[model samples]
Target: MSCQEPEFVTAEDVGGFDDLWSSYGFYNEGCFEKGAPLVLNDQQLFSDFAFMDDMHFDSISSAISVAAETDQPASNSELLQLDEKSTPPLPSKTSELLSKYQFKFNARSGEKPNESIERGGSKLSTEDFMRIAASFFIQLSTHKDCNPFMLNNQFGLSFSGLSSAEIMNVELAILLFSAAEKVSQQRFDHGTNLIKECYKLCSKTGNSVQRVVYYFADALQERIHGGKGTVVKAQEVMKALLSNHPVHLATFRSLPLEQIMQFTSVQTILDNLGSAKKIHLIDLSIKHGLQWTILMQALSNSSSVDYVKISAVGTSEEEITSTGKRLTSFAEILKLPFVFKPVIVSDIKELKEDMFKIEETETIALYSSMDMNTMIIKPDRLENVMKVIRNLRPQIVTVVDVEAKHNSRSFINRFTEALFYFSAFFDCLENCMRGDERVRMIVEEDFFSPGISSIVAAEGSERVIRQVGIDVWRLFFARYGLVEAELNQWSVYQASLLVKHFACGESYSFEVNGKALLVGWKGTPLHFISAWKFQ
Candidate 1:
């Protein structure tokens, strides 16, 4: 057929190689000279629909049809954003609540209160400190035994606990710096006014914290303006800011709650199966069993499947204990005879040998919510993981993780949800009053950085140190010729939506004013299937 001639293709078609080529350059360059509508081939009709219903895209089928009629395929990049217009309106209740908090706290003028938290007064009473300390100690003491499920329910550091004045000092400075960087239009000068104000309030001997803040704001301004000597300036500033600081890089070594949430997000995308066998969850870091606790609960409640065995892997022993305990408990609750094994390797070469120890079976479902993202960031680590999973060839590898896009570029609908929900949780903690109102104070004053609040509000856990979930899953499946599974479960859908929401914010805007496409802070739910059948 002539390039311009109408041709038939399956409506179920993801752009074919030819369409991809044309979409990239040829078609846009006038390769298709005809105005005639393409009679695209269609896939088998849905069982109930006699017509070729299965061939169609559900939400954006109309847009796709237009592209097809023009002898050009819709670009994948644009297709990803098609849903931008379809975001459901946010609930009025949610909007009002967020607005109230935003006005109350974000609008506050002058320096934030003496949140400097000194010991004395009923506001800073010993009883209050003891309560906070007790909760903090429990988390530290149970680090090896605490999983996300347990910790999530308790009052502990959602990301990292802040108790020592030294840790808090460094953390607060960083938070201010990051916040200043984000809000500043010039990237460098936005927080200068604030810093200068802080200086005036400082003690005469030159408070290092205030100095560090001033230096950081100066360095940030330099970096944004493309001024010379940015790196050296930043380094110097960092040295000064962190110098003599109590908490070292070692204190910030492990992943945060935000990271762990990515792994659990995979569960939200899973098909609510009534029954199944072994399930394999993969990830680079699995400390304190946070993600596993969530997974165990998901499995126990899954309507579609029942799991008898679970194979989980972590980068180290320190990350495995809590996950292991949670998994064991989950199995016990369900009264299912289960074996939870941790895949470990002292060396990369050993991983291959140890990986083979798991039985190759058809009934297994491989769930790697955290693995894929870490692999994307560190492809080398994924090579062995991909090979092992490919060999075992589990029924499904459901990936749940944070999308790699920065918060600014995330899908708007999910982003809104995330902003609203996260703000609610954060406000709950930050708005803690002194005395009986400690919780609000903790949220507001304790975790000031977007990073910390972000982790605590949504993703606080060990899940943060790995690769992006989507990229890792895509590559892993493609390497083994696996197909992207359909999401057939509601929980999986919720998980996806939750993640999308987590990444969004008020800065997001749609093409129109009132029709704002607020982020839902959730994502599309998915169900996965295998191209090849299990044994």
Candidate 2:
């Protein structure tokens, strides 16, 4: 929740593009940071418009297709060519590996959504709105596979049913804030006017709803103003919202679009283990531990894994305890000697070699699915963290990170990249969650909305939303002397299996760059999972 200011020495990169790390957006402070007004004089010369790979996005993962060979830096010609045509329909195959473990999603809407905000929502009977809200929360918060747009039509419908325009304003505020990913300017403009009306109507300056509304207004406004977000305000509102509606945070579990890849990466590390006695799975950011359950089942099925132990680290002690107990119960059921060691840390930085109590003889595998890299604030921090990890000498360090370059100190470049990345993402969501507006609302409110705001608004260490390509991580690992272990064929196949089984019509492509497996929708790299070993 708090940011760690990782200090780095200013080492200049004079010959920018030719250097390996240049395209990856890992440069010294002097080379990248624009003091106040975004000045990227040096970076501008080396800059190329970064966009998707040879990606043609469709409705679901089935329709989406990727050309794995196209990892080239983007060009104007390519962009122009891409602009002219619709997403090229690419073919995908359903492998046998998908049948055993597949994450599925289908957008189901009871009634079709309306055309626009111009035509106001249909009126509902008195007190029916509460039932609707309850239904929305249950179906969305509970089910991982629910379509995001499940309640899309309810936005205007809910507004129409409210007794006072004041409550309607509040509802509009929530919808507009959540729908930033795929709403038109006209709808956004109408929501803006409603927000202004709420300010005029409601007297409570400290009201929680008012605060959330204003905070989202600021966040959405900042994105419109070239993606410079109101970070402090956004975080404050986010903290407040989490305090009031705790379940909002758990919305991620319902939609396990990428969990299959994460588990595969963990299983791959587990598979690589030799004849070690106690195999320790060190999960840096273990949330709910459901992903671990999948790996545990795999381990239980096999007679090989004798004593499987885990060190589950998380920000929430309650979550850790519950996950630990859950795993222990499963292990008891399986009758395997499994030890669940749950560690509570305020920050992931607290996760160092000293925190781990593994015996010298035990084999350890570090599993970080979409979190460990964010702990790295700067190059110096990475080096320091790498030292700790290096000391631990984990047999394999599995990492998964977003592909878009969000690390650029320069605002303009960072904003542009984020916009491009999210646009494709929104389009993908639209295709996948087309009819399910209700599910779309939850996904946007809990996940994508915050991501957009955080990336666009926050600066420096506060901008933990930063993501980079695999090459950058390749450099960091290589620099720290951690040997890159290419994700195995089985791991890659597992990833492809998820896409094959669950992608609906969306196509997902997996490519290997050196020692990393890059998984992207259409052609743009969404997530990259890699493995490393200590030299």
Candidate 3:
């Protein structure tokens, strides 16, 4: 096919790749100027879908409103505009309620109320103080083997001081954590009891916290019954795949996580490729070939890109073929010289270098997102895969995976890590999809629930959700003679800008550790994206 002339358009005119960022005012003449501090339009910082409607935020606001009415009536404006620097004492009722829950209020000199609450110090607005107390309750339950009944008593100490929503948060946290603790101890009966109580306290259609807790409770119940509770027939799996595929795609469009990784990977590949005319991408998990659409668009805009080929690797031949066809169609639309090659393998470990059919002229880049971690369950298979990758001599290998340490041998340790990790993730989803509960639940149930089940319910090799931190990944890559490649500042800045455009963006942060970019939520690392080149 003859390629069309490259079209030059402004960032605002570009869709697909640039739509999310540019619409939020991330693109301008001096937006990406080197050494310039990344600044976002304050007005565009919070989207309509942002987390201002968070259940905890609302509950806290309600509780504070009640406190204000009793102590000294304060207007809604006064409540919101409270001085962050001042350490205003909480109402006597709120203080007693916190004290009963074993949460102390120690306001530090000149510290923000939120920061103080995070550090176990407080003189927070009644809202922030209650939110912190709920978090403390979860932490205390998870980290310590406290009696659930006692915790429940503490929660019941002064419901008059709390709104109905606040009471539900307390009840759900205690029940969910208590149930998780029992499951970890192998006390299946006890776990079942607490999970039942959790079910009664929360609903799948309820608030964000309720929905997340409900799912976790379901996973705990499955754990008690041993491994999914029943065998999943192939027909059932296929049926689920068919039903959930649309929701999955919608999630990709709605959430920034997947796009952030893909954008970074594509940028890394383009940076390394320079003016190479022949490009080959070996996708470890091609799925729907969504990431490559961005690459193809960029390549179509570049005169240097003469030929493009993708060897999509996946387990299902049908799915891979479908992805190849879709990409081929997209490539034709761009009038780009493109070839879609499907490399089907029964298992990722079965991958052979010859399967890729690499040509000497082709500049190759390998992209793996949440795929290699599955192979870690069998070290030999993973090492063999790495060996094949090393021998292929790809110009750059991009990796994006969960930044959690869930590969621990101890069940309790792994459970604790997974609980906190998924909690943050679900909380993030709640913020990102505040008004759109249906899509949010679909993503949670279809995409996230299985991973949670595998981590909590399965054992040994059956547990395929083995995610490790970047530190572990660095060590593993080093053993394979791969050196980390530094991600450019432009990519990091774009990622930061992308995150700040969402609700609760202040809670989301980006940190650079050596050669990797870590995406964190509320100070806890959730995922990392990095690039590596063979030494």
Using lDDT as the measure, which candidate wins?
Answer: 3
Task: Report the lDDT tens digits of candidate 3 across residue range 368-483.
Answer: 87766665555555755776887798999999887876665556545555666777777677767777788987767766777777766766555656676676566456545678
TM-score-wise, the better of 1 and 2 is: 2
lDDT of 1: 0.33
* lDDT of prediction 3: 0.61
My TM-score estimates for the predictions, one after another, are: 0.39, 0.57, 0.69
Worst 10 residues of 3 by lDDT: 1-10
Position 353, candidate 1: lDDT: 32
Q: Model-by-model lDDT, in order?
A: 0.33, 0.49, 0.61
Global Cα RMSD, each model? 21.5, 17.5, 21.3
State which candidate, 2 or 3, has the greater lDDT. Answer: 3
**Model 2 per-residue lDDT at 349:** 49
